[model samples]
Target: MPRYARSERQALADLFQTLGPDAPTLNDGWTTRDLAAHLVLRERRPDAAGGIALPPLRGYAERVRLRIAARPWPSLVDQVRRPPAWSPVSNPLTDELANTMEFFVHHEDVRRGRPDWLPRDLPAGLHRALWKRATALARVMLRRFPADVLIQAPEYGELSAGRGGEPVRVVGPPGELALFLTGRQRAARVQVDGPALLADRLRAARLGI
Candidate 1:
């Protein structure tokens, strides 16, 4: 697949400028400036990036992110627009693997944060790539879920996960399915097939990215 990360990076930079630094984002309590600063720190600061997942470092991570956010908004967003050459995560070699979903999800985070936003008309190749990644991620994120989950992505393939309970089938485009599985169920436009209560529970259940 073509490098989607670069395009998304540029798109988010543009959006940040368009909406202004005070714009809201789907990430609770984070403004556009906050999101931009987090992106900058993720690629540039190795010591704090682990806070995204590891609870032990979360405090440090937030402190570092806040410190970056305290800088001038234009400079921070520009840093997000242009990743440093030495950035381990944003450089050409790792950008595709590490930043595609990162940027895409965050792009949607900013998009869906506002009212009347619609899904992007993504390329087939990008959808398939997202499907491949979501499938692998589902194996892990859904492993402990209460119900047995089936993810159906049209023109791609399907992934069956979750521990054991009732079987709930999730039907959507690959990108939507990825969003649903990654803690964005409230925003993901997908059809859930199976019992009504089970479906509600599935959508409400905690999902890790």
Candidate 2:
């Protein structure tokens, strides 16, 4: 199988080097340097990574991330480029399952963050991979949404999410659907169909892991 996790990791690292430290990303206030630090911290310091999803641990995680972010730019990007072989998340055995959606999303974060951005022509195989990941992600991220949610990647697959209510259908390619479900709704080019108010709410909802 193709190693998308490894490829995306390397591509993101190259993009960081090309854009330099100050470039923006779709991740709210995070710049390229900040994103690089987050990646490095996630892979290198698993102890601090938990704070990403737990409010109680976030302060410590942020502190550690800031320190990592403060490293010289080349050093920080290098860390992002080369994850530790023994890290639980990025080791060869687990890297694909863990980092495919991660690096893909963050790669688009930086790509779509720019004013002159255009979508890439992704390979069909990668599209299949992303569709698989996106379906699983939508199941988790949209589980508690107010309306019944149907996510479709026309050429790949579809899946349902949300609790239950009036039905809403989101139609787009897998990668864009992934972006929408991950809180980049404004930046993702996808179609939403349902009651106006409910659909609008779905778009505005805070999403992602």
Candidate 3:
């Protein structure tokens, strides 16, 4: 099997180096430097990683992350590219399960953040991997959505999400579906087929990890 996590990590790091520290990313207020620092903290600093998902720990996490972000750009990108063997999420046992979608999404966060960017031709294996995760993630993130949601990646598979109601069908490639489910709805090139108002609402909704 291909090590998508490793490949995506390296690609993202190279993009960081090419774009420099100040380049914009799909992460609203975060720059490329900020994203690199976040990746470093996520892998190396278990203590601060909690802040990424937990509200109460966020302040301290943000402090540490900001400090890390201030390091030299090349150093930050290097840290992102080479995960330490001792790190919790990036170690041999966990790296694939943990970072595949994480790195893929963040890679696109930078790639599609630019106006002139175009989608890449992803490998079929990676597409299948992404579809598996994207389905699981969609179920979680869309659990509260007011309508029944059916997500489809024609070459892979499909699944239903959201609270019970009128059905909404979302169709796209697995990678684009991943982006759509992860709150980058505007950036994802997916098709939503449902009630006009509901489809529009789905696009505008805050959906993510």
Write down the RMSD of all candidates, one decimal each: 1.2, 0.8, 0.8
lDDT of each: 0.88, 0.92, 0.93
Candidate 3: the clashing residue pairs are none
Evaluation by lDDT, superior candidate among 1 and 2 = 2
Sort all candidates by lDDT, best to worst.
Answer: 3, 2, 1
Q: How accurate locally is residue 34 in candidate 1, as Cα lDDT from 0 to 100? A: 89
- Model 1 weakest lDDT span, ten residues long: 200-209
Cα lDDT, model 2, residue 166: 96
Best by lDDT: 3
lDDT of 1: 0.88
Cα distance off (Å), candidate 2, residue 30: 1.0
Candidates by TM-score, descending order = 3, 2, 1
40, model 3: CA deviation in Å?
Answer: 0.7
Give the Å shift of residue 121 in candidate 1. 1.1
lDDT by residue (tens digit), candidate 3, 1-209: 79999999999999999999999999999999988999999998999999999999999999999999989888999999999999989999999989899999999999988999999999999999899889889989999999999999997998998997999999999999999999999999999999999899999998884
TM-scores for candidates 1 onward, in order: 0.96, 0.98, 0.98
Query: lDDT per residue, candidate 1, 127-150, as tens digits?
Result: 977888889888988898778889
